[model samples]
Target: MDLGVKVDNLPAEAMMELAPRVEAAGLDEFWLIEDLGLAGGFTQVAAALERTRRVRVGLGIAPAAVRNVAYLAMEVATLARLHPGRFLMGVGHGMPEWLSQVGAHPASLMAALEEVTVALRRLLDGEQVAFHGSHVHLDRVRLAHPPAVPPPVSLGVRGPKGLDLARRIANGTILAEGSALDYIGDIASAAKGLDHRLTVFTWLSVDSDGDTARARLRDTIAEALVHPAMSVQLRSWYKADLTDAAIDALAVAGTPQDCAAALRRLADAGADAVILQPVRGAESAQIASLAEDIRPLLDAG
Candidate 1:
């Protein structure tokens, strides 16, 4: 299993510092989040790639609804050509509210996502795309300079239909933060026959005291409970209460040993890569612990 750390929507400058740290620590991948108002995904990815030599850089998702498919393909192709096998791209349906706020929500999010992903992949593969779907319309569009080796494109989506679409068109599936073991297993099972990568993002917090570490995630867990995608994963364990066990199921928290065990469970449940997302104030320390403490335990086990 590949281990990675997410630079979650942090300031752009954070990459200059964090990317090298991740590579020095021997992490396999460095991921970035591209929320609506945050730093641009492509920009951060370029900066991270520029700063690091080994660690693979990924944009956990660029909202397909807002970007034209051809333009998105160009940006991805440029990065792939420059970095070769070191870039991973994720495209998805943007958050409904966020898309609406920006006046970019499509009439059919699923159609838009599918169309964009298909066209984007085709363009990356150096195909001349002439597509006329419900949402995406292109007439003989192709990249001027396609990558010799195309980058992997994953779909960041939650619903069943979206997952099915990912299976059909994407190289991988990106499960968001708060993904539980059962959910991961289910996704893995569904992709049984295909050569698919299941990349899971889970919350991470670590300290000498396991209780203190777990406690730090309470507020974030409470907030996650309300999101539709997160709630699906938590609902099986959630019954009128949020208990310690439930928290353990959702996050890789606690002491080094505890965090290692949590990550192991995720891997055993079929996670190709488990991306650790640190709680807000504890980013640097958690990354260090993940590298120095948790990872060694996992390696030994």
Candidate 2:
């Protein structure tokens, strides 16, 4: 039940300021959205690292389609070097539109990701990656300035095969299936009792104003409009009037007590940490409120 929250908006100076407040709240990590559409992930990460002292800063899975395995490994290594043990990396196969928008070829996504994951780890170990892989290779390249201590890796996966890949390769696996707890058993079982962390990402809104919470969720839920798997899961879980065909149940919008209670449910289910991805128009007050309220549940559990 560790509380981790996403950071998408805030001024350059405000980002640095965000670190102290986030740390003060006893959050396990600051999950920065390396949102390509909004800002450079590295840019915000550097700022977060510079601004915070002990709170770990993690990229919320930089799209593997956006960069090659070599550059990706270098970037994460650089972040770790800059902040020492305070840096972490995660990777995800992003949406088709974002992949196409960047003109990055992401076809055969499963194969592509499998290759990327192995190469990145090799580079992190400061070894020359000489794989003759289809998607990624180092040939003779190695990390010039590698991390003194290897940071952790988490996979952003929603499907079965992706979950299996995570179990095979990553230190931990993350689930973002728009609130469907149906797959937790399948995902957990795949881990085979490996001492790996499990994370679940969901939309979390907390305010006394109920209508305002729902209003904020509408804008955030739009992406599910085009994703069927997400839509089906949401419809099955809470019977939400899930209009979006694509978006699953990644978001949870409700009053403070209700949201807090739901977070406890995730911990009770199996997640070590619950990443709070607030959709459009989310505010820091929600986090501030959670720090004031929900943390006790985790400690008690």
Each candidate: RMSD to true structure?
1.2, 3.4
> Judged by TM-score, which candidate is best?
1
Q: Residue 166 error for model 2, in Å?
A: 1.2
List the global CA lDDT of all models. Answer: 0.89, 0.71
- Structural similarity to truth (TM-score) of each candidate: 0.97, 0.86
lDDT of 1 by residue, 1-301 (tens): 9999997667789756888989988899999989988999999999999999999999999999999999999999999999999999998899989999999999999999999999999999999999999889999998889999999999998768988999999999999877768888999999998989999988888999988988898888877766655667665754325667867889998899988889889989999998888878677777888889998998999
Name the weakest run of 10 consecutive residues (lDDT summed) in model 2: 242-251
Off by over 4 Å in 1: 238-240
Give the C-alpha lDDT of model 1: 0.89
- What residue pairs clash in candidate 1, if any at all? none
Range of the 10 consecutive residues with the lowest summed lDDT in candidate 1: 233-242
Q: What local lDDT does model 2 show for residue 16? A: 60
